[model samples]
Target: MLKAMVLRNIKLYFKDKGMFFTSLITPAILLVLYATFLGNVYRDSFTSNLPDGFSLSQKLIDGTVGAQLISSILAVSCVTVPFCSNMLMVQDKITGARKDLTISPVSSAVLSGSYFLGAAVSSLLVCFTALALCLGYVRTIGWFFSGKDILLLSADIVLLVLFGTALSSMVHFFLSTQGQISAVGTLVSAGYGFLCGAYMPISSFGSGLQKVLSFLPSTYMTSLVRNHAMRGALAQMEADGVPKVFVDATRESLDCTVEFAGKTVTIPAMYAYVGGMVLVLLGAYLAVQYLAERKRIYS
Candidate 1:
């Protein structure tokens, strides 16, 4: 029965045309546009600052482009998955289909689990697809993720996908209409790039803005991905004997290791924060479900 429900939701998602495109369009456009326009601007700035006799401009440009694409992927992945995941719940409510199922012998637990699980799985697929597309974009810039890089990227995807699922679940409980979901979805999809540090480095923000964005998964997501994806480029620079000062400056400019409360958050700590957010958000979701169930029985 659980399997049936999950499969049904996945099938329905593909059956809808607009939704299928919405999941891909925002992220894809961001990746292509930013990498094309800003990638060169940053690359030019990056190359110009180096002392004379540095012939690494072309390679550095590729690396900067790769780094930007990684940022684009995170913005795309975080927003794409959650935006696509919640629609199942909204659709069931809007079409009155869940009412019939709720009246049946099925436990609310099973129904809820089915919907969340279905969304989780759907989001996972969407994230992986984004990763694959990002990988292709990364290659276009003359770089590729090594095996270890792929493994790390995969883990990041898993954690971010979980966070996205929990976020969708927790938020959907309050929203009982498709219109509300669409409005929120549109806003998030449109704004997440700015909110999450995808369009600009986190370091560029004012202290107050940084404090607020630091609490969001997108902020951490950007840091984590840029750190990992840019490793190859950084390593290349290191190998080319780029000065320590320049390397450090580049890393800081990209917001690879973010500082919060005067402490640097390493890649491991960022992963922990993301993983913790997943647990916290999912717990809140379960609590909301329990409360809603009790209210339904008593009312």
Candidate 2:
């Protein structure tokens, strides 16, 4: 029964062609912006502070900036894509489908699980496709990632997807109308990237703003992806005779190493923060479900 419900939700999500493609609009827009002029902006930043007569290869610079662009897309997509994918719950409520399910043999717990699992799976599919396309683009510019880096990146995507789905599920439970969901989705797509440091480096913000962003799980998740994506390019810069100080500075500036309250956050700490948030959000969703079930029983 659980499996069937999960499958049905997935089918419905994909069957709507408009919704399926709309989930990808955020990433698509970022890609177009990069190709048009964002690419040059990143390239100039890479070379802006070089010592006189010190030069890096164009291929290396392109590869580095390309990695940063893809990482930002991945981070933002984890949230925005899930926001679209999880709308099935809101649709079910608005269309009376959820009430229909309540009369069936399927338990409310299983129904809720189906929506959660369906959203996670659907979002994962779209995010993986985006990752593949971004990697292919990076290869054309200059491929630097090793086998291990790819494996780590895949793992990062899974973690972020789970986090995204849980967060979206909690929010969707309160959204009873299509208008509410659409408005919230638009707001998230517009603001989440900046809040998470995907559109601009957190280090560029004022100290107070940086400290506030540090408390967000999305911020750490973005840093994790950026760290893996840019690892190879940063190493290649050192091998190409760039000074160690310059390489370290680049890493910090790009947010591959994030700071919180005057302390550098390690990679393990980033993973721990995201993982903890996922667990907390899932627990909160279950609590809400239980409370809603009790209300239904007493009413």
Candidate 3:
């Protein structure tokens, strides 16, 4: 049943030529464009902007840059999935497909899971391809690496996909029209991208802004990826000019440890956020089902 749902989504997605290109081919092309032409220019420009005395390793800075590019690119793809999925949902709702799907032997869980799985698979491929391009660029720049880093990077890509899936699932039910979904999802994704520190350090953001961003799932998701990619390099920096205390604090913060920088901070609860989002979306699905059932009875 899951396989059937997955295949159906894949087929439907590909059936639209414009969406197919936007979701898959567009990111790949943008990555190539950035790496081949724009990346060096952007890096040099950004590096020049940094003031002296605030030190960062080349690897960490580059990792952040790469992450920005990947996250920016993925943000577009993220909206694309929900935009398409919600459009499909809206169409189904109008055409009685929602009622039909609700009444089918497939449970709401299975149906929702299947849609999420399909989105997850597509998101994973796009993110992994983006990561590969970033890593290849890193290798070309002569950054250190191990087999373990590659494995961890792949795992983070998978986690990012799950994060995106959760985000899209949460947003899908809130809007009925494709245009509304696309507009709102794009806004939300952009907000998440900023809040997650995808383009800038959350630490640098004002305290109020950071506090607000703390509730966002992407903040945790992006930090998870950035930390994993930079962990070894950050560890090595401690032996160099960076203070051991600073490195320890950074490591502790990234590892989700509470004690950092002479303060006991409670770790942000990403799992709870994901669980709450799942329940909210499930409730929404049930609400829509109930409405459809009542309409049928009344009609």
- Candidate 1: stretches off by over 4 Å: none
The sequence of per-residue lDDT tens digits that candidate 2 reaches over residues 226-271 is 9999999999999999999999998888889888878898999999
Q: Which one wins on lDDT? A: 2
Best by TM-score: 2
Worst 10 residues of 2 by lDDT: 28-37
Q: How far out, in Å, is residue 203 in model 2?
A: 0.5
Give the runs in model 2 whose Cα sits over 4 Å from its true position: none
Estimate candidate 1's alpha-carbon lDDT, on a 0 to 1 scale: 0.76
Candidate 2 displacement at residue 40 in angstroms? 0.9
lDDT of each: 0.76, 0.90, 0.58
How many clashes (backbone atoms < 3 Å, residues ≥3 apart in a chain or on different chains) does model 3 have? 0
The model with the greater lDDT, 1 or 3, is: 1
Task: Judging by TM-score, tell me the better candidate of 2 and 3.
Answer: 2
